[model samples]
Target: MAIATFGLTNIHRRVDITEGGVLGMVLLLDHHFGIPPWALTTVLDAACYLLGWKVLGRDFLIRSGVATLCGAIFFRLWDATGPLLPNLSAQPLLAALLGGAFVGVGVGMVVRQGGSSGGDDALALVIAQKTGWRLSRAYLFTDLTVLGLSLTYIAPLRIVWSLVTVTVSSLLIDFVKTVGHSENRQKA
Candidate 1:
């Protein structure tokens, strides 16, 4: 998709779209508007950090930390590279699809590993635990809210693409985790 649009295939593909990465992407994408992405990212990271220590224990927190850091770093790289690529209007749909998929996968991996990317993701888990709803459902609710907020900075269509990307990413993560669990049970 990227190749056809910008002749760039590895731009966002290599970033890994973890929570931090997504935060970075959010910053990069919205840099023109002077949005305070670091402020948000810091708060989210603190939340994840606290959750990692208190709610999820050290082991899981470590994994989440790794994912968050990876996401953030990759996001920065993507931001730096943004100038080289065509702007969103060049291929908005493709950008949205890939962007959403990248971030969603990052979120799923962190969550599946018993951690979170941050912000509403952590809040979603807390809500799920307290309210007894499924995690995926909680994630969906959270994503919907985020998608709505995204519309303020981006085109309506771009917001939709982000939603699609996240949805696909989450599904893929869950599928992998579920299969792994099933395989483990069979071995047992």
Candidate 2:
């Protein structure tokens, strides 16, 4: 389940991957060196899962598992459909808005279930555990940092688009916690 979460979720939804970057760096290295990056990432992800299970317990394990599965499946579908989409850069703002909003909602659902989708998600949990910081705030800060760093590679306007997406994502995650979870509980 945790494996699935890694495939989904984003910062705009208040779930960041800063710490995941640490692991990502390892994955990147594997890519750069011609090693199977996914292999390494999978191992790292598994280790993280174990850590979560040991420290964070069953709920987190379940949450992480479902989120990871959903993320992987959703992203694979999104990517498969990517070829059908038009050029977003023609109207960067609109692209960002739509992309971020969609990603945000998807991510929000993962978070609301109490499973981190991936990367900085584990870090956010670590921060929460070590310093008692609110996971939401930690996630936002980590994601913003990531988005800012992304600007170095992508254009400034594109960065803005990413931010819009992140905002929508965050809002969605919050909504999940506020409304979705409650409704789910009532249904149960």
Candidate 3:
């Protein structure tokens, strides 16, 4: 889903709007420091996974590792096949909405399974554990922070749309988590 979001954003010619996590930070670095987003995301996600191991337990780390690996592979594959994909540049809003949905569903699925795609998920979990906040709230806070910082580089209108994408993605993530937990509770 993350890869889909990236591809959609690229195809739409819109500023890449990501769910705030290490991915967002990497994008910022790419824009500001000329660092490659893939390399930075990998390193940052590895660090986040290490932190997850300490704070979220071994099982969490293992599952997150799987999610991370899958994400990396998918991203690479998407990059390789991008040229053959359909162009959606004519419909930026539609692209943003669909891209956000894909990201929300993808991340939410990983998280519902006691796994994370690393980066923001791990950080959000840690914050929720420590602060007794909802995971979605934690994610929103982090995402907003990144978007706020992004204003330095991204155009104002683009940032607004990015915020819209992030907001939609966050809401869907919360919905997925809530539905999953409710089902689990009923089973219990």
Model 2 stretches astray by more than 4 angstroms: 1-40, 43-51, 78-87, 125-135, 180-188
Q: How do all the candidates rank in terms of TM-score, highest first?
A: 3, 2, 1
lDDT string, candidate 1, 1-188, tens digits: 12211222232433322222235345544555666876656765576567546765677667666665665565566456655644444564566566555445555556766766555456656655656655555566666665666555556654555566556655554443445663223210
What C-alpha lDDT values do all the predictions have? 0.52, 0.54, 0.71
* Model 2: per-residue Cα lDDT over 1-188, one tens digit each: 32222223322222222222334345345545766767777876787677767777789888887777766676576555443445544565565565555644555566666777765566556555666555555556655776665554455664565566556555555555547343433211
- Candidate 2's TM-score: 0.61
Summarize candidate 3's per-residue lDDT along 75-97 as a digit string, tens digits.
Answer: 77766655544555566576667
Candidate 1 Cα deviation (angstroms), residue 74: 4.5
What lDDT is reached at residue 119 by model 2?
53
Clashes of 3: 0
Question: What order do you get sorting by lDDT, best first?
Answer: 3, 2, 1
RMSD of each: 7.2, 7.0, 4.0
lDDT of 1 at 120: 48
Poorest stretch of ten by lDDT in candidate 1: 1-10
TM-score of each candidate structure, all chains considered together: 0.59, 0.61, 0.80
> Per-residue error at 124 for model 3, in Å?
1.3
